[model samples]
Target: MSLAELLALVNDLSQSDKLSLFKLLAAQIPDAELQVIFSASEYPVWSPYDATEAANILMQMIEDDKEASTRA
Candidate 1:
């Protein structure tokens, strides 16, 4: 059957059946192909911990703004 027809049939499947279909399809794929499809990479994440410099800069900006407002 065409992919569109197969997808339509798959759409009608229950959640458990869909999960089974996913496992079956994944089993057919080679390890290398799966690795390529799901590449591992590190991503930088921002944390508030050890952010004293940023906090100081923000406080300075606030102070500058307050000083400017008082002068106005």
Candidate 2:
């Protein structure tokens, strides 16, 4: 599905469903460490388990989306 289509669908999912989906994505890929890109002073701890783990999860999600779309 297109990004616009995906966004529309994602917007309709329940909070619990979203959380469950996130946990499932995390289980598939090990958590990735992320460093703050703006400053060099201090790097904040980042993980797929963190609140924004959606960043990492989205990356995997996009790849999966591509494959699924291709198959369709």
Model 1 / residue 25 / CA error / Å = 1.1
- Each prediction's number of clashing residue pairs: 0, 0
Q: What's the TM-score of each model vs. the native?
A: 0.60, 0.38
Candidate 2 lDDT over residue span 47-66, tens digit each: 65655767778889999999
How far off is residue 60 in model 1, in Å?
Answer: 1.3
Candidate 1: stretches off by over 4 Å: 37-41
**lDDT values for all models:** 0.96, 0.77
Clashing pairs in model 2, backbone N/Cα/C closer than 3 A: none
Model 2 alpha-carbon drift over 4 Å, by segment = 31-72
TM-score, model 1 to reference: 0.60
lDDT of 2 at 51: 56
Q: In model 2, which range of ten residues has the least summed lDDT?
A: 30-39
Residue 60 lDDT, candidate 1, scale 0-100: 100
